[model samples]
Target: MDLLALETPCLILDRGKLEKNISNMHKRMKTLGVNLRPHGKTAKNIDVLKMALEDQAGGITVSTLKEAEYYFSHNIIDIVYAVGIAPVKLDRVVALIKKGARIALILDSVEQVKFVAAKGQEYDVEIPVFIELDCDGHRSGVTLDDSLLLDIGNLLHNEEGVILNGVLTHAGESYNCKSVGEIRDMAETERAMAVKCSELLRKNGLPCPIVSVGSTPTANFAEDLTGVTEVRAGVFVFNDLVMAGLGVCDESDLALSVLTSIIGHQKRKRWVITDAGWMALSRDRGTASQKVDQGAGLVCNVEGQPLNDLIVSSTNQEHGIISNRMEKDIDWDSFEIGSMVRILPNHACATGAMYDRYYITDGSTDIIDIWYRINGW
Candidate 1:
């Protein structure tokens, strides 16, 4: 089926670009001599996961238990729930463990460790765990000098039903880096921090086997991965405006886009309106702080080539307003009402969550496959 024939405001994935992105990242990780545990949170589809797992160690990192269950059901069992686990969510984790899923939980608090241990004991499961570390203070995790690091490690290692698997940290601040050199520095810091925490654990007579660290920017620019066991990156699978703005990927490498049609025009305001609004494109303005601010998205022709200086300047719940950044008048005839266009998102993960499936294409209008995505939780 042709992509234009499908309903407007849908997701279109370029399979060729997607495959190239995955292959390149795999090669990069291989060169660094670290295992690639691709995060499933970005592309929540099993089809994408299968392609990413190639040459990997069969372990996946997920932000939610639903992703863990969905991927586990597809036989990709080695999993890491990368978010700080809540006491209430342990039952679901335990259920997956009992079903033969080697799921690892990450948390930074002693309270979480106690909860996990109690749940594991009650369920008779030896739950694997990773102590989350704060590499750059971007989000959750314990600091290197924080005494809680050893406290949690000791509790996890000595607990009855919990096994301290290792340490994990994400260099989320890499996204804020202004240059590739900055990203490289953040990558080194991320790797060094995780490795140091692991060393500290081992120094205290505890086993720290898995040392994980990653974020798309850090993963792509890391010059070394000396003691790191695995790298977890997700947005690399579908480069967005944010990744492009960060120089982690070129704009041409973006593989995910929203397909929409021109619905109306305001010649007075030089606005080209479309059915794809924030509801379809998402409200993530991740590129706003970057050098280039791609509004809602960068407008593209039907062939996926970016239009000259065009962008979705604004959006309502169900209407996207396309305009030129230079404030030039649009060639109305070239974008007549009902003419189809594609929008490259600012954040692939956020935009992807607005859709339920991907209309796969090999860089063409001809739709080749329909890949379903899991949402919620």
Candidate 2:
């Protein structure tokens, strides 16, 4: 099917760009001498995961138990539930473990360690876990110098059912960096913090086997991964406007976009409206703080080429208003009522969650294949 023939407000994935992105990240990890455990939260599709895991270690980092279950059902079992585990979810985790899934959980607090250990004991399954560390204080994790770090590590190491697999940290602040140099620094800090925590644990007679750290910005710009065992990144698979704005990737490297049609127009206001509103484009204004604030998304022609300085300036529940960012006159005649256009998302992960499937293309209008997404918790 041709792209134009597909329904509006649908996801379009360029196979060519997708392949290039996966290859580039894998090559980057190979050069850095670290394993790449691509995060499954972005695409949420097994086909994309398979492409990412090719010629690399066979492990995945997922944000939810549903993702772990889905990927495990497909036989991709070496998993890490990167989010802090809720006590109520222990049963589901144990169910997967009982079925032979070598999945690991991450937690920061001593209370969480006790809960996890107790649950593991209840199930009589040896559960693996990583002590989350706060590298740059971007989000969750125990600080490297926190006294609780040793306590949690010792508890997991000595606990009967739970085992301390390693330490994990994310340079989420790398996304806030204004330059590549800053991202590189953030990467080093992330790696150093994880490695230091591991050393602290090992020095105290505890085993810290894995040291994981990553964020797309850090993974792409990291100078070295000397002591880091694995890197986890997701948005790199479909570079978004936010990533492009951060200088992590060029706009042309983006593989995912929302296909929308010009539904109406306001000639005097030079506004071209589209069917893709926040419902389709996503409410993630991730690029708003960047040097270049792409309103909702950078507007492009149906062929995926940017149309001057066009952008989706504002959106309602079902209406997207496209206008020139520089206040230039829009060529109303060119964007006719039925003409189709594409909108690059600000955050690929959020925009991707708005859809159930991806319309695959080879950087053209010709649709070659269709891939399903695993959405929900």
- RMSD each, Å: 0.8, 0.8
lDDT (Cα, tens digit) per residue for candidate 2, span 288-318: 9999999999999999998879999999999
Judged by lDDT against the true structure, how good is candidate 2?
Answer: 0.94
Q: Which residue pairs show collisions in model 1? A: none
User: Please, what are the lDDT tens digits per residue for candidate 1 over residues 1-377?
Assistant: 99889999999999999999999999999899999999999999999998999853489999999999999998888999999999889889989998999999999999999989999999888999999999998989999999999999999989998999999999999989999899999999999999999999999999999999999999999999999999999999999999999998899999999999999999999999999999999999998999999999999999999998999999999999999999999988889998999999999999999999999999889999999999999
- Cα-based lDDT at residue 126, candidate 2: 90
Q: CA shift at 373, candidate 1, in angstroms? A: 0.5
Deviation in Å, model 2, residue 302 alpha carbon: 0.5
lDDT of 1 at 246: 90
> Which number leads on lDDT?
1
Clash count, one per candidate: 0, 0
